[model samples]
Target: MRADARKNYEHLLTVARKVFTEQGNDASLRDIARRAEVGLGTLYRHFPTREALLEALLRTSFGALAKRADELQASSDSADALITWLQEIIAFTHEHRGVIAPMVSAIEDHESALHASCVTLRSAGAALLARAQADGKARADLDGSELFDLIAALAWLREQPSHASRADRIFGVISGAILARRP
Candidate 1:
């Protein structure tokens, strides 16, 4: 890419991040282009679709979340690692607001721009869950896909104004259910 083009791309991402944070994942592309002081055509040149733009914006964070899972696996107790990673992913989805829908859909859609990142993150969570189960710390009936679905549900609550206040309490409830009984 040319220097000017690269600058525009970066600028768009910055502006899009702000806009998405304020208005959510459904924020208008035209508004992002306007905020970035770029033409809509220019935005399209860099990101042909909304999913493409989202994938670009979220790729780094997705990698970090996966890496965090790996770090937790090595450094934390099995159940603690699993719960910590779950909390992080839930917080991540809350930060991006309204991203859970696209992420959930992308997991089953190989051609989606977000598919690879979503799959990798899910696999990371799955590994943590498997480790916990192996250690007899988490419920054996739960699998990675179910864990991902639970995340989606939990994150959906966070996105709602009415439910946001209780989201953490509910997270505690869900996490408790995932753990095995000690006595």
Candidate 2:
């Protein structure tokens, strides 16, 4: 891309992330274009679609999560590593208001722009989960997919206005279930 084009792309992405963070996925593309001082055609040329824009914005985050998984797998207690990464996943979900909905959908729909990254994030968590299970810290029956879903559900619950305060307790209950039973 040309220098001007690259600048516009990065500016659009910055404005889009701000708009989405404030007004969620429903935020207008036109508003993003306006804020970025770019034309709608330019935005379309770069992103093509809302999902594409979101995928572009989240690609770094997904990569970071994968890297975090690698670090966690060796950094400390297996259970603590899993818990820490789970919190990061939760925080990532909470970064934008409605992102979790699309993320969940993307996990199931390979046609979605975010599908591959979502799978990568899930597999990252799964590796940590496997390590936990191997260390006898987590339930062996639970796999990475299950753990990923559990974190998504908990993150969604944490966002709910009514249940928000109890999220830690809810997370605790789920965490307990994920742990192996003493013989």
Candidate 3:
């Protein structure tokens, strides 16, 4: 891509992320182009469909999350690392709630990109949980699948307009439950 084209693409992603957050996944792509100071043709050239745009956004976001998990694993305290990772995930979900609904629907509809994202997140969370459990900081019985379910539930809850704060509370409760000292 040309320098200007790359710049416009990045700008579109930034504008689209904010627009989707404020206006949901069905937000106007034309308006996004207008806000980004790019033409509608440019937006379509970069993101051919709504699903394509959503997948790109999620891939970008989740890729960062996976990197954070890797960094957390390299940190000193395993328990604190797990807590920090969970907190970051919760914050990401909160910020991307508008896209969550459509991404989830796409997943249910067998979208390959969304499925790959789910697999990546599941693997990252499992690695973190395994490390925490092995270090004797987390519950030995809690599997990755269970933890993923909890995160998904929290994400869905965070997506609701009325339940914005619920994700934090849920995270706290889950962290305590998983990391509490065993008798």
TM-score each candidate.
Answer: 0.97, 0.94, 0.77
Return the lDDT, model 1, position 74: 98
RMSD of 1: 0.9
Clashing pairs in 1: none
Against the reference, the lDDT scores of all candidates come to 0.95, 0.89, 0.80
For model 3 the local lDDT of residue 161 reads 71
lDDT of 2 by residue, 2-113 (tens): 9988988888888998899999787999999988888899999999988899999999989998999999998779989998899888987877777888888899999999
Ranking by lDDT: 1, 2, 3
Best by TM-score: 1
In angstroms, the error of model 1 at 26 is: 0.5
Model 3, 1-183: lDDT tens digits are 999889888889999988988887779999899999988998999998877877788897788888889989998888898888877886787776565565455544665557777667767888898999998999999987777777777777877778876767776787899895966
Better structure of 1 and 3 per lDDT: 1
Please provide, for model 1 over 51-100, each residue's C-alpha lDDT reduced to its tens digit, 9 standing for 90 to 100: 99999999999999999999999965899999999999999999998899
Which is better, 1 or 3, measured by TM-score? Answer: 1
Ten residues in sequence with the least summed lDDT for candidate 1: 75-84
